[model samples]
Target: MAPAQSGAVLGLSLSLLLGACRIQAVKLSSDNLTPTVMEFQSVELSCIIKSTKTPNPRIEWKKIRNDETTYVYFDDEVTGAFENRADLLNRASLMIKNATRTDTATYRCEVVAKSDEKTIDEIKIVLTVQVKPVVPRCIVPKSVPVGSAAALYCDEKEGFPNPTYRWYWNSEPLPEESKSHPKYVNSSFKVDPKSGTLTFTSVVKADTGVYYCIATNQAGSAKCEGHSMEVYDLNIAAIVGGVIVVVLILALIIMGLCFAYRKGYFANSKPSTSYKTPAKPDCVNYLRTEDEGDFRHKSSFVI
Candidate 1:
């Protein structure tokens, strides 16, 4: 073979070798970029090695939540809250045996292969853990007067992705617009699903019924027990009669007090004069001696 041709062939071989090295550089990928699972259930975050030259590459996983980052896997071991419940699958993927709501966040998987031309590569995965809602706390008034205002409330705190509220009256769901539904046309109330408040602008006799509330989210729903609310009409005649009776009684009391004052029954009595006797002398005696020719003698003695 010619020397020039041999040199050209060697140069071509070197170029192909470099191209191969570039093609085999460390690379990472994921089968599922986003995975969702129910709370307490198991889930796997797929991190696959697309291409790499290193036989034993360094793998690490970090979780990003609320703009904060923390390690889930480091130093070839699971760490933090996932220490006991998580493990690596295929030496690259992460498997959580018991997922929780707090585990829902963005996760990053990184691989470092020093032997490869490109030393590092990474991929991101999003996890969502859905939590079922517990029974909600509900407050309903026991009684309300007709034409008066009333309010009912419901709330739940355990669900993931904050829950919305729904109210039921006598086992029937209440619509958001009362006038839109014939069954609820008699009620003058408003429902606030986000705040879980049911406000009655003006209650009537038809508003009396058994009420219950339900809280719902993407995971599940829960409801409180039913409570009865009574609405009664105001007895105007009876109330007026009672007021008149009270006023008459008060007036009679005032008249009795005035009559007692005018008759001198409550007047102050006249004060009587007081007399005091004079005190006698302590020890003094007077004696008359006729034998001494009308002589008077005075003596002082202690008794």
Candidate 2:
């Protein structure tokens, strides 16, 4: 009786263990694996999975770069190649650090049970990681004064691959070295190759005009709307200069008139003394007097 009882207990334990080992069904649901677009240094890719069966089933994460296949994430024990670069999130999620264009590929998640049959389930996702400079709308200063610096800014928040940024003024593209315009030609105007942020140290009056920014990538291209740039105090200066010139001209005209009047008045009015040798006849010079008319001699100075 004792032996039979012992045998019955062993059989029950074996039955329980076998029942626990057997897998009823394997259900798999993947967290969204949408591709992300970001700058070169700012990319993270991860996937979540929910398994209804055993929590510790053998799992594998694969990458399909170009036409090649590579494993980036695995079960609890990640491969040495992806040791610090990959992480497992919670019960069923995989994360890749610092994702790049090279990391873009099709990934797979697989799970297999420990049963004798070794049934397996799997799911695949495509991830495209983008890495490039950020480029955004161009904003120009209200006014750029001569001998002063003016700034042209491009927002660096929107783009994919990211993008390469270039600025244009009045439809003409300015190179990195042209310094004809002093205020807007400083080194600060150049944007960082990796990032698309620019600054103008000083702006000149010639810098006033319209400006635009262009963003491009291998995938696509775009351009920002043109913004206006104006010069300061130009109208006031022109008005003042014109007024000064007109006043000077009027003063010269008045001085010339006064000088001509003085010359005419200062001229001598004396008669010629050389002609006194010839005398006129008295009879011809006598005035006619008739019917009690009297002649009055009025002295008229002709000197």
Candidate 3:
């Protein structure tokens, strides 16, 4: 009885393993295998499924950008931003018309078959759209004072494969050597090829000229309109000297006033001692009698 029970248990385990190893309902693949194209061109990103149990499989396409997945093709129709420029046919193959750089992204082709329990097959394909360089915008200062820093800026934002830069003066390429030209003879000028920044530590009159910049990539090249740069003498030393002279004059005036105060030149005057007054001696009074009325004499005091 123990042997029979053990055999039944082994049979149940075998059934479970077989169920887990069932064959996939469908196999999905892309026709292009690896797709790459230039900007503003048509391309096909086709997906096909084989050996599907369901006659009609639900098809979908999704794109991934910046770690976010968004739907592009579904419900037997192209929807979202691609509705007007894309079409889905032949088991949900994607056909894009007039594709632009914005279309560059990773696309996933998904197919679902409904049988005894739904099954899905999906594959990912990356698309790249190359773009050429357009005319870059460049700015050169109208005027730069001598013995001061100067900067020239250039920008080219629309390009694929990235863009490189070159600068020109008077319609000629910039000199390779820093001191090779008269304008930059002082070794104060510098350039950055990647960021397109040209600088001068101490600009000079010789540095004045028409300047332009060019941007290039694998696809194409472009140039900006020529701009003018003028460098003039600032006479900054003379101005600074004048300021110092004025400050010294004011200092001298203040020092003179302080010295005068310390020497008592601003002290108060001393009191006077020149004059005196006389003193009175004494006062005497006499009473008048009736018999003496005829005599009628007034007494006076003398000092």
lDDT of 3 at 50: 53
Q: Give the TM-score of candidate 2.
A: 0.38
Which candidate should be chosen as best, given lDDT against the real structure? 1
Best-to-worst TM-score order: 1, 3, 2
Local error of candidate 3 at residue 60 (angstroms): 0.8
lDDT of 1 by residue, 1-303 (tens): 999999999999999997797767988888899998999999999999888879899999999999999999999989998999999998799999999899999999999998887899999999999999899999999999999999999989999888999999999999876888887788798889988999999999999999999999999999999999999989999999999999999999999999999999999999998888966454544455766654333354434
Q: How many residue pairs clash in each candidate?
A: 0, 9, 0
TM-score of every candidate: 0.80, 0.38, 0.59
TM-score of 3: 0.59
Candidate 2 versus truth, CA RMSD in Å, comes to: 22.4
Question: Model 2: runs farther than 4 Å from truth?
Answer: 1-23, 37-49, 116-118, 134-213, 216-303
| Top candidate when judged by TM-score against the true structure | 1
Cα lDDT of model 2 by residue, 223-255, tens digit: 778888886655778899999999999999989
Task: Name the regions of candidate 3 deviating beyond 4 angstroms.
Answer: 1-25, 31-34, 48-54, 114-118, 160-162, 175-186, 234-303
Computed on alpha carbons, the lDDT of every model, listed in order, comes to: 0.91, 0.63, 0.82
